[model samples]
Target: MKSILTILVFLVTFGSAFSQTGEDKHPLLTDRFIIGAGWYFPTRDIKVEVAGDIEGLEDIDFDETLGLSQGDNTFNFVFFWRFSKNKFWSVRGESFSVGSTRNVILDEEIEWEDITYPVGGEAEVSFGVALYRVFFGRVISSGQKHELGGGLGIHGLNVKASVEGEGFVGDTSAGFERSETEAFLPLPNIGFWYTWAPTDKWAFSANLDWFGIKIDNISGGLWNVSPGVTYQIIRNLGVNLNYEFMNFNADIDGTDFRGSFDLTFSGPSIRVMGNF
Candidate 1:
């Protein structure tokens, strides 16, 4: 937590250290408010390790151990607002979700949350994550057609994992429906962005967001990066295409569960944008 705080202080003051703004800017940067709704196509690689009242569990690969889809199409939304006091200062928010459920025959002995499912039995397995991010930032430097800035933010996650199969119930064989665990992780992060407009109708941008630290009962890192271009359809509207990569790794000791997981999502995206 101490390491995270040290970074918090550094990123919060990032703007004042080298704040600069360009008089000439693109419509996307100068807009007071912008909203976007997009679709993302990404491949996922997930591995989970968990135990209840037990330890030394092995990692379970979602794709190899269980038959879950390795790719998905999902919706993402974004909003940004530049403060009236300083166009160089702004706050942005983003949200997205990815997950799936599948039923398959168990290939090896499985133990999760005190329940055991022997090989050859059928099981239903599911995993999903919903993400939210909000950041406050400033433009540290700018030129006629470009701007650069860094900021601090929080990456909030809602993670759920579950496996259901027949297991012993107090020494008696019984059929079970569901056994699942959910965790909420709110982590702090630091991010930087660059935007350039070569013409009034076309603009290019790239953003990098990352953080790694141990906070209380949770420990690990998060990374999100996107680079794309925008084409203005009209004065108040546009379209954007970007390739984004996101990964999250964490170990948790929480009220509902204790476990660790690593999830990766990366792919291309297309969005419709409104600028004002």
Candidate 2:
């Protein structure tokens, strides 16, 4: 009887301790905060034509075609705070800002004095900000050590464009300028991400996001799609390699302007991130 009692007591103690330790170490999906930086490069092309005759020149033509091959690099910072994190679902709020400059080349061939004159061109810059994003995701794969998920988000953006130029007409210098126009609108975003952990203290991830906006008042829009990979150097610190493509287009407002204008940009970027 004594032996049986001692064995029963030992079994009960071991079971209780095992259960407690398992509960403490069990995998959990919980809310988290993420902060990161990103770099952006934008290349663009614009085509503008005027519809009406200027200065009594019947069938007037002003063709401004601009192309940007090498773009200016801009920095971006983002914050995402998760409200819920479950095995199969998650919700988050995000904010980010990105900006870049586009080298503009205006190729104007005018028919004047019954002769074709090639007018020189200039460049411009554009920038944008995403004020808020609300996102929802579903986890497709979840294991003791790995997670994979895809999600969609709604975003609000504020974007602006500006132009400055100096060129020639018959060996004379001329200048042109335009103020920045602001576009504010809502956009939809979709993304997928994979997270892996080789050890208890190390984790790595890769993700891609796509979003766009259409501004009716400005007669133009902007779209961006980015893919990036990150390595967690520590629990909350990371570095990333990202590549992105951004497209922009707008119309010239005056009746004197006789053509349509369009632009596009693409490039690779590098960045770093942290979670607090």
**In TM-score terms, which candidate is top?**
1
lDDT of 2 by residue, 1-276 (tens): 999999999999876643422221122222266666676664434333332333443322111233332345666666555454443666656454544456555465433222223445554534333445566878888665567888987666554444445533446655443424455545577877776644333344555556544444335444556655555555567676666565544443433333333445566666666664
lDDT of each: 0.86, 0.51
Name the 10 consecutive residues with the lowest summed lDDT in model 1: 15-24
Candidate 2 regions off by >4 Å? Answer: 1-31, 41-69, 85-134, 162-181, 197-225, 246-265
The number of the candidate with the highest lDDT is: 1
Screening candidate 2 with a backbone cut-off below 3 angstroms (N, C-alpha, C), the clashing residue pairs are: 43-264, 43-265, 47-261, 49-258, 49-259, 50-257, 50-258, 50-259, 51-258
Write one digit per residue (lDDT tens) for candidate 1, span 62-135.
87798888777999999999985768899999999989999989998777766677789899999899999999
Return the clash pairs for model 1, or none: none
What's the CA error at residue 258 for candidate 1, in Å? 0.4
Q: Which portions of model 1 show Cα errors greater than 4 Å?
A: 1-24, 53-55, 168-174
